[model samples]
Target chain A: MSWAWFHKLGSPKWFFSWSKPWALPLFCFGCLSLLIGLVWGLVFAPADYQQGNSFRIIYIHVPVAMLAQSCYLALGAAGFVFLVWQMKMAPVFIKAMAPIGAVMSLVALVSGAIWGKPTWGTWWVWDARLTSVLVLFFLYMGIIALQNSLEDQVLANKAAAVISVVGLINLPVIKYSVVLLETLHQGPTFTLTKKPEMPAEMWLPLLFAVIGLYCFVAGVVLWRMQSEILMSEHRSSWVKQEVTKHGF
Target chain B: MAFNSLTEFLMMGTHGVYVWSAYGFSTLTLVWLVWNTLATRRKTRDTLRKRFLRNQAR
Candidate 1:
């Protein structure tokens, strides 16, 4: 693939300005879609014949679990970019994404526990899927703590990048944990490789929720990225001009 | 709607506590994360702009 456009993305000023127009709209769309999906999934969608209304939690749980894993993948990819191309924005992306990923992982874990109590009759069990996800949460916390512990920004980014990449090995394990082991956790309701084992009525809102969550994550990242760019590049001429232009 | 009334929806059949707690926690996470990031961004920008202006005066 051509590398020219890829390098252009390295420029924070260009990205900050280029992403501005769509970011707000995307966030609003995410909010709107999530609201609709939640209402549809919780109120209108038929209750599970087995799990009953407890299955309503799936609308939130699945989206967040997917986001937690997806964000880690993103962190790993950004780490790779930082290590290889030394893209300035890549490290900034890693820093910005870590907390967001951590929170999502936490929500996934907590929601899983909540969902588990009613279904499994316990708050937590050392099931394969649950354990792997707990590990994911810890990995996210490790990246955040590691980034903060270092004094030198560049060195910190580099060290964290290595950790992120190494942790990328866990992604497949988390995804396949249920299939590979005897897990109390249910199998994937939505899989890209094959038709989901859920009805259209159930999976349809789930689709919306996933897309909405992704959009939400993207918008929040861009929001933080713009702020990160401004703060980091405050002394740069472009940032100075923008500050004056915006009367900030 | 799956339930017959507002009360039924709140009850969520027999699993009301689990359902509500999960949703409540998820909502809190989403709200708090977004709020904290925006707050941090605003504070950083304000502080940076202040420093920039002070530098300009010197």
Candidate 2:
């Protein structure tokens, strides 16, 4: 396979232009599917015999929790890439994605806590799964804080990359926590190897919710990356032309 | 439909507060992220335009 495409992606100008046309469609489709999934899950799907309507929180909770972990994984990979190849775009991806990841983690934590209230009879627990996710949230915040505190761009990138790379240890711990240690949290609901232990009525809208959330986050990340690119390449003639053309 | 009336739908069989609050908070967070991204993009363009115009006049 040609590595040319990878190299092309390293260029800020190429990325900015390539991504511009994609953001709107992704956002629109994401919003549509997300809305459908939420409404279906909340209003149309039958209530769980045991948990009743509160189980509907799973629609938002699972998707954000899944994305929270995925975002951290992406950060680790990007950190590794930046360290190995000195890829300029890698740090930008990390910078743009950190806040989003942090927010996802926060949502996951809050929603999980909310779900736990009626289900587990508690708002918070220091169990393996829950605590590890809390750690993930802290890791994200630490990276964001590191980037903001450093005045030197190169130093900031290097520091953030190192933290992101090191923090990858948390992902597996978060993944297997429920099984590795007895916890209030349940085991995986969606697994590739086995069919979900849920009825079609329960899992179908969840499918839409997951896909929609991923697309929505992707679109927002692209926009943030574009903004980062423009700021970093402000002096470039292409950026000048691009900005002027937009007439914003 | 899960419930027969709007009131039941809203009440969510007594789990209404927890379910709605979770949804409400998650929705607000996601919306804010999108809004903030667009606002930042616009601000960046505005700053760049002013700089370009300033340099052109010089």
Candidate 3:
């Protein structure tokens, strides 16, 4: 593929128009996969021999927890794009992604806690995995706060982008903290470096959920990016013609 | 396949509270994310519309 497409992506109008057709179908597919994954995991999958029904929490917990860290990395990537290319749309993406990432972190933390209560016999723990995830949550919140606090949108994006890049240092620490610290938390249940011990039946739905969540995240980001483009390009002739064409 | 009856599924074999709460919270967060994105888009479009009209009238 030509690298020319990457350069074209820097244009807000071009990106907005390109994303329009894919948004609806992607969102629909995401919803469908999520529903199927939920049903398959929650009802059809055999109960864990040890945890029994409580294991169902894995369906939501694993997906959101994975998203929490991945979304931060995404924000950091957007920050790099913003800084290097000075893409007008990059900041908008960073701004829109902040809250969504924060919410994902929140869900991950809360669901983990709930899962812990039944599995670990406590609602809270200072385990490396748990603590690192909490830090991730706070980092997401800090980025969001920084983005909204600045009056100038450009400055806000720059500030948040800086924070996002700094916070990315924590993702590795979160992932490896368990191993490096030798804490109470167990080793990774899923990892690129090791084979997963989970049965196919159990992991299949989790796989679906993870893929679905990714599509959903992309859909949300595209929709938000389009809005950002409209706001930033409000005075541009293309936006005027586009809006008039859409009767909006 | 996991539960024997509807009640058993609802009860989640006495793990109902935690299981239900996790699902409920996940659903709530997803809904909130969708609503926030849609609302932001609407607000942006409205602001652009107003600006376009104001400039046109001038």
Strongest candidate by TM-score = 2
TM-score, cand. 1 vs. native: 0.97
Q: Which sections of candidate 3 miss by over 4 Å?
A: none
For model 1, the interface Cα RMSD in angstroms equals 1.4
Candidate 1: regions farther than 4 A off: none
Best model per lDDT: 2
Which number leads on DockQ?
A: 2
Ranking by DockQ: 2, 3, 1
**DockQ of each model against the real complex?**
0.75, 0.84, 0.77
True contacts kept of 1: 0.76
Docking class of 3: medium
Q: What would the per-residue lDDT of candidate 3 be over residues B1-58, giving only the tens digit for each residue?
A: 8778999998998799999999998999899999988898888877777778888899
RMSD to the hidden true structure, all candidates: 1.3, 0.9, 1.7
Q: What DockQ was computed for model 2?
A: 0.84
For B1-58, candidate 2 gives per-residue lDDT tens digits of 8899999999999899999999999989998999899999999889998899999999
Whole-structure CA lDDT of model 1: 0.89
- Candidate 1 vs candidate 3: the DockQ winner is 3
Q: Worst ten-residue run, lDDT, model 3 chain A?
A: A182-191
List the candidate 2 regions with Cα displacement exceeding 4 Å.
none
Tens digit of per-residue lDDT, candidate 3, span A1-248:
79888888788888888888887788878888888888999988998898889989988888888888899999899888888888777787887788878888899889888888988889888877888888988888888788778798778888888888888888998888878886655566678876778888888898888888878888887888788788778778999887756853
Candidate 2: tens digits of C-alpha lDDT, residues A113-139: 999999999999898899999999999
Q: Clashing residue pairs in candidate 1, if any? A: none
